[model samples]
Target: MFRLGWFVNYGFGAYGWNQQWSGNVAQDVARPQLFEQGAQILENAGFDYLMLEDASVLYDIYQGSFAYAARRGLIRQDPMPLVPLMARATKHVGIIATMSTSFYPPFIAARLANTLDHLTEGRFGLNLVTSSPHAAAQNFGHEKHFEHDLRYEMADEWIRAVKALWNTWEPDAVVYDEANGVFADPDKIHYANFQGRFFSTRGPLNSVPSPQYHPVLCQAGGSGVGRAFAAAHADTIIAADPGIDGMRGYRDDITRLAEENGRSGKDVKLLHLISPVLGDTDEEAWARKRAMNAAADADQTNQLAALSYISGIDMSTFDLDEPLPELSDRVNGHQSSFSVFAKLARSGKTLREILKSRRGQETVELVGSPQTVADRMEEVMEQVGGDGFLVVMPFTRRNLTDVGDGLAPVLRRRGLIRDGYPYRTFRENLTSF
Candidate 1:
C-alpha cells in the first residue's frame, strides 16, 4: 500500500491552448473554477495532495527566440492566489505550492507558506526549489543563475532561515484566555535572528506555526548536490530514476543519507514519477498506451526545443540522424536534466529518437485494466522498497474520472489506497507511513 499524488505542470498547461479540446476550456488557465474542479476530483479520489509545479521564466531557449513558448503559451500566471482557491475547494487534499529559493527571499517564502498553512488548515506543502532557468535569473535581476552546487548552498541556508522564522512562535504561545485578559504568552514567543550565507531573518512570524508546524517539504532532487539537499531537508523527495534497479539504488542512497544525517529513513518518503494509460482490458490498455507513445511527436518537438533552450544549443539546427556531440560544458542550467538528455544523445540515439525516448524517460509505465495496474504497482513497490508514486497523465476529465472512479476503487478494494485520511494535517497523513 502507498500514498499517491498528482503533479501539475501549471506553466505548461498554458501551452496546451493549442490542443484539440482547447476551445472547450479556453479559460481554464485563467479561471479558478477549472482548477477547483480538478482539486475536487482528486479529493474525491482520496488522493493525498495536488502538487502545483511552477516556473516563472518564459522559456525561449529552443531557437534563440520565444516563438515556440509564446505561440504555444508555455507561460503562467502567478500561483500564489490560486493556493487558497484550491484550498477553499477541498478539505482533505493537501495543496502543495511550488516556490523558489533561488528567486524569492527567505522571509517572504516563510510568511507565505505559514499563511497558506493557516488557510489550508495544515493541508499545505512547500515544493521548495532552486530555480534553474536562464530567464529566471534575469527576471529576478541577476546576471546569471548560480552554479548547481552554489544554488543548493543558497537553498540550504534559505530553508534553514525560513524554518527558523517559522519556529519563532511556539505552538503554546497562542492563548485566547479572555477571562484572564491574557491573549498569548510572551515567553513562548521568541524572535528569530537567523544569519546564513544567503539570508538573514529577524522575526517572530506574524502567522503562528500552522497545525503541521511548517507545511510538508516536498523536494525534487536529481543531481548529487540536489540529492544531498533533499536528504538533509526534504520530508518527501520526488524522484525520476528509471527502472527497478535505478529506483532501488536511488531509494537506498537517499534513505542511507537520511539516516546518516540523523533522521529515520522511514520519515522521508520517496515517490517516483509515473505516466499510465488505463483502460478496461489488457488489449485496449496496451493499444491505448502505444497510441499515446506514438503521439510522442508533441513531446519530442517541445522537449527538443526545451533541450535546446536549457542546454544553450540550438538542437533545431542539428542533424536529426547525427550522434550528439559531447556537451560537457554547454549546459548552464539544470545539469541533471541535461545530463539525462546528454546520455541519450551519447548512446547513439538520433535527435528524433531522443525526443521520443524523452516522452517515456524515467517512467514506470502502468498500463492495463485497473486490477492489472494495481498488481504492477504492488510489484514495483515491493521490488523497489517503495514510498509511493506520483502520476502524470494526459489532462482530461476522463483521465481523472478513470483514476478516481475506476482505478482508485480497485486499489481500495485491494487495500492499497487509504479508506480515509487518518489524521487532520497534511504532514500527519503524508508521514502516516
Candidate 2:
C-alpha cells in the first residue's frame, strides 16, 4: 500500500473562504475548532499526515498594491500555534507545520520542534521553507530576500546547526534517579558550538530530546540547489511536477542526489502533490472539473496575482495575450516556479493561456468517480515506482467529506492505501511500506 498525506493552508489564504461550500470557516478562521475537526477527519480516513502550508507576508507584488491580497485573505496567520491543537485531536495522524529558514533562528526552530514533538508525542514534523517573497524579507528587517541559490545555501547551514542542537542531548541523557538526587545525566549533554557564514549557535538545546529524537524533516525544494539540500537532509520531500514522466524524472534525480550525498534513495520518500476531482459518477466529476476551470478562467487576474505574489514579479505589467519574455534569471522569489512559467512561455503559451491552464501546475489532475480516480492513482504509483501522493485541496467541510467519506472508502476497499497506522511515530509509519 502507498502512503497518503493531505496538504492544506492553515485556513490562512483564500482557502474556500466565502465560497459556497465553506460553511462558517471564514467566520471561524481565528479559532482552532475547524482545524481540529479537519485533522480528525483525515486521521479517521487513515492519512499518514496533515501538513499546514504557510507564508508570512502580506503580498503586494502583483500590482504594487496590497489591497488585492488583503481583500482575498491571502495574508496568513502564524501556523505554529495550531500544531499542538491538531495533534491533540488526532492520535495517529502526523501534524506538520511550516517554518521558514529565512526568518527563524536555528536554535529557536530546533527548540520549538523539540517542544512540539513532545506535545504531539513524536507525531510532529517540520516543513522547512526558504521563503520566496521580498515582502516577507522586509518584515524581517531585510531590504530584499536572499538570492535563490543563496537562500538554499543558508538553509543548508541552518539545518546543520539545528541538527547539531537536536543531537546535543544523547538518547540516554535523561535518567530520573530519585535515590541519588539526580534529574539527568549531565555528562551526556554536550555543547553544539556551531558556526556558519549565515548563522551561528552555541551550546546544547535546552529542551530534552522528544519522541522521534529529531522530528521528521520535510522539504519542498523544486530547484536544482533546493533538490540538493533536500536530498541531503529531508526525510520526506513534497514534489509538485505536473505529469507522471516529470514525476519519475524528479524522483530519479533526487535518488541520484541522495546517493551522491552518501544516503540511499529509500532515505528520502518522495510524495507527489495531487488534487483529484471526484464525484458519485464519472460525468459529474468531469463536469465539476470543467466548472472549476471555467471559474479560474473568469478570474484570471486573481490567479495571476497569487502567482505573482510568489514569483516576486508584477505580472500585471506584462501583456496577458502575448508570450512571456525570459524572466527566470530575474526572479528573486521562487526560481523553480518562474522556471515553470518560463517553460510554458517558451512553448508559445500566452500569459493568459498559461493562467487558464494553471489549475494543474501545482498538482497533477485526476478527475472521475471514486473507483476511476483510485485506478488512475494506482497506475501513477506503479509508473513512478514506490512512495505516494499528497492531496491538496480547498479546506471546506464539503470538500473534506468528498475526499474522506467518499473517495477514501473506494481507495481503502481496493487496498490502494493503508487502513490504519501501524507505527507510533510518524517517520516509522511514513517509511513503513
Candidate 3:
C-alpha cells in the first residue's frame, strides 16, 4: 500500500462557493469547524497528511488589476493558526502548512515548527517555500523578489539554519530530575551558532526536542534548483508534472538528486499531484469531467488571472487567439510554473486553446468509477516506481466524501492503500510503506 495526502488551499477562495456540496463553507469561511471536520474525515480515511497551500499577497498581475483575483477570493488567511486547530481535530493525519523561507526568519520558523510538532504530537510537517510573487515580496517590505536560483540558494541556507536550531536541543537534553533539582541537562544543549551566506542564527532553541526531533520537511520544487533543494532537505516532495511520462521522469530526477546529495533515494517520498473525478459509473465520471472542462472554458479569464498571479506575468496582455510569444526567462515569480506555461505556449496552440485544454493546470486527472480510478492510481504508482499521490482539489463536503469515503475504501480493500496508521508519528507512518 502507498501513502495518500490531500492538498488544499486554506482560504475563503471562490473555488466552490457556488456549488451546493460546499454547504456553508463560504458563509463560515472564517470559522475553523469546517476545516477541522475535513481533517477528521481525512484522518478516518487513513490519509497520510493534509497539505495547506498559502500565499501572503493579493495578486494583481492578471490584467494589471487585483479586481479579478479579489472577486475570485484569491486573498488568503494565514495558514499557521489553522495548523493547531486541525491537528487537534485529527490524531493520525499529518498537517503540513506552507511557510515562506523568503519572509520567515530562521529562528521564528524553527520555533513555530517545533511548537506545532509538539502540539500535534509529531504529526506536523512544514512545507518550505520560497515565496515567488513580487507582490508577496512587497508585502514583506522588499521592492523585488529574489531571482529564481538565488531564492533557492537562500532557502538552502534557511533550511540549514532552521535544522540547526531544531538540533540545538538534543534528543536527550530534557530530563525532569526533581530529585536533583535539575529541569534539563545543560551539557546536552548546545548553541546553533549557524552562519551562512543568507542566514545567521546564534544559540540554541529554547524548547525541548519534540517527538521526531525534527518535524517532517515537505517541499514542491519543479525546477532544477528547487528540486535540488528539496532532495537535500525534504522528507516528502510534491510533484505537479502532467502525464505518466512526466511523473516518472520527475520521480527519477528526484531520486538521482537525492543519491547525489548523499541520501538514499528511498528516504524521500514523492507524491504526485492528481485531481480524480469519480462517479458511480465510468460514464458518469467522464460526464463530470466534461462539465468541469466546460466550466473552465467559460471562465477562461479567471483561469488566466490565476496563471498570471503565479507566473507574475500579465497573461491578459497576450492574444488569446494567437500562440503566445516566448516568455522571458527572468520571471521573479514561480519559475517552474512559468516554465510549464511556456511549454504549453510553445506547443503552437493558441492561448485560449491551451487554457481550454488544461482543465486542472499540471495536475493529472483520473476520471472513472471508484474502482477504475483506484486501478489507475495503482498502475500509475507502479509505473512511476512510487511513493504515493496527493489529491489536489477544492475543499467541499461532497468532494471530500467522494475521495475519503468513495475512493479510499476501494484502495483500502484492494490493499493499494493503508487502512489505518500503525506508527506513532507522521514521519514513521508516511515512510512505513
Candidate 4:
C-alpha cells in the first residue's frame, strides 16, 4: 500500500479566517491545543508523518497574527519545538521540521535533528531546503538569495559534511566504559573536514547519532538544481503539481536522475500534494469549497493574495480578473512555481481565469463524497506512478477531520491506506527498507 502524510498549514480553525498585515493567528487560536488535536486525528488515521513548514518571517497577509505572536513573546517557539510534544502525544506518527541548508551551521543542524530523532524514538524527519525567497535573505543579513546553482552546491557539500558527522559515532560507540573512566571511545569519532565548491566544514557533531542512522530526508524542489539535490539525497520527494501526468513525469525524472547517479528509483518515493474537499455529494463539497474560499479572502482588498503568495512578482500590477503574461524569468524563488505560472501564461489564460482554475492547479483538490475521493486517490496512485500523497488541509482542523472521518475509512477499505502504522521509523514507513 502507498504511504500518506499531512502537510500542516498551521493556523485558522478548520479553514481559518484571513488576517491583515503583521497579524499572528497562532496566539488567538491557542495553537498548541489545536496542534494536539490535529496530531491525534492524523495519527489515528494512520498517517506516516506531518510536516510543519518553518518560516522565520510572516508576510503581509499574516501581519496581524505575526505582530500578536511577537507582542506575546510567543515568537520564540520554533516549529520543531512542537515536534517532540506531538510525538509524546501520539505513538505512530512521524514529525518533520523544515531546516534550511542555506542558513544553519552543519554541526548544529545535525545535532538538532539527531536529538529530535532520539526524543521521538526514531520518528523524526528532516525537510532539507535551500532557502528560496529573496526576502528570506534580507532577514538573514544577505542582500539577495544565493543563485540557484550555488545554493544547491552549498547544500550538496552541507549534506556530505553532516552525513560524515552523523557516522562519526558508530552504532556501539557509547560503551559507557566506567571501568576505564571513559564514556566514549575516541577512535569511534572522526572529523569531517569537508571542502567543496561553496562551503568548508569540520566536524563530528556535538551529539551522538540516533538509532535511525539519521532522520528521514524529505525534499520539495522541482527545478534542475532541485531535482539534482533530491536525487542525490532525499528519501522522499514532495511536489506541488499533483496532476497524474505531472507526477508520473516527475517520478520518472527523479528515478532516472537517481539511476544515473547509481541509485535505484525505489530509493526515493513521490508524494503529490492532495487537497480534498469532502461532503456527501460533489455539489455539497463544491459548495463548502466556495464558502471556504470566500471566507479566506481578505475581503477583496487583497484578492490577489494567492498570486502574490505563489509568485513574488506582485500581481497587483495586473488586473485581478485578467490573465497574466509569462513572467517566469521575472519571478523569484522555487522554479516549480515559475514553471506552473509559465505554463498557465503560455496557455493564454487571463488572471481571472487562472484564479478560477485554482480548484486543483495549486494542488489536486478532490471535491466529492468519500467514495469519490478514494476512487480518485487510488487512480492517481495506480496510474500516475505515485507512491503516496501529501494532503494540504483547507483549514488545519477541518482538513484533518475530513481525511480522518471521510477519506480514511474509504481508503482503508480499498486497501490503499493502512488501518494502522506497520513500521516504526519514518524512513522505514516511507520506503521498503
- Cand. 1 TM to true fold: 0.95
Q: Taking the tens digit of each residue's C-alpha lDDT, what string does model 3 give over 305-415?
A: 778877888889988899988876557776776677778778899999988877564456699999999988998888888889998888887888999999999999999
* C-alpha TM-score for every candidate: 0.95, 0.97, 0.97, 0.88
Please identify model 3 stretches exceeding 4 Å from their true place.
Answer: 10-15
lDDT at 312, model 3: 82
lDDT digits (tens) for residues 163-238 of candidate 2: 9999899998999899999978999999999989989999698888899999998998788998999999998999
2 or 3, which is superior by lDDT? 3
Q: What lDDT does each candidate get?
A: 0.80, 0.85, 0.85, 0.73
Name model 1 segments beyond 4 Å from true: 11-16, 20-23, 309-312
Candidate 2 deviant stretches above 4 angstroms: 10-14
lDDT of 1 by residue, 191-248 (tens): 8999777788899888766888878998986788888888999888888878898888
Collision pairs in model 3: none
lDDT order of candidates, best first? 3, 2, 1, 4
lDDT tens string, model 4, 1-433?
Answer: 7878877654222234443222344443535666777788888887778887665554432232234333333222367777888888888788888888998878788888889999999989888888666666778998878877778888888888778778878877777888889887788887877776666667777787696888999888888888989999988878886466778888899999999888999999878888888898888998987886775442432335444544555555677556676576444566775667667667677866655555343356677889988888887788877688888754345567778877898888888887776677778877753
Which is better, 1 or 3, measured by lDDT? Answer: 3
- Higher-lDDT candidate of 1 and 4: 1
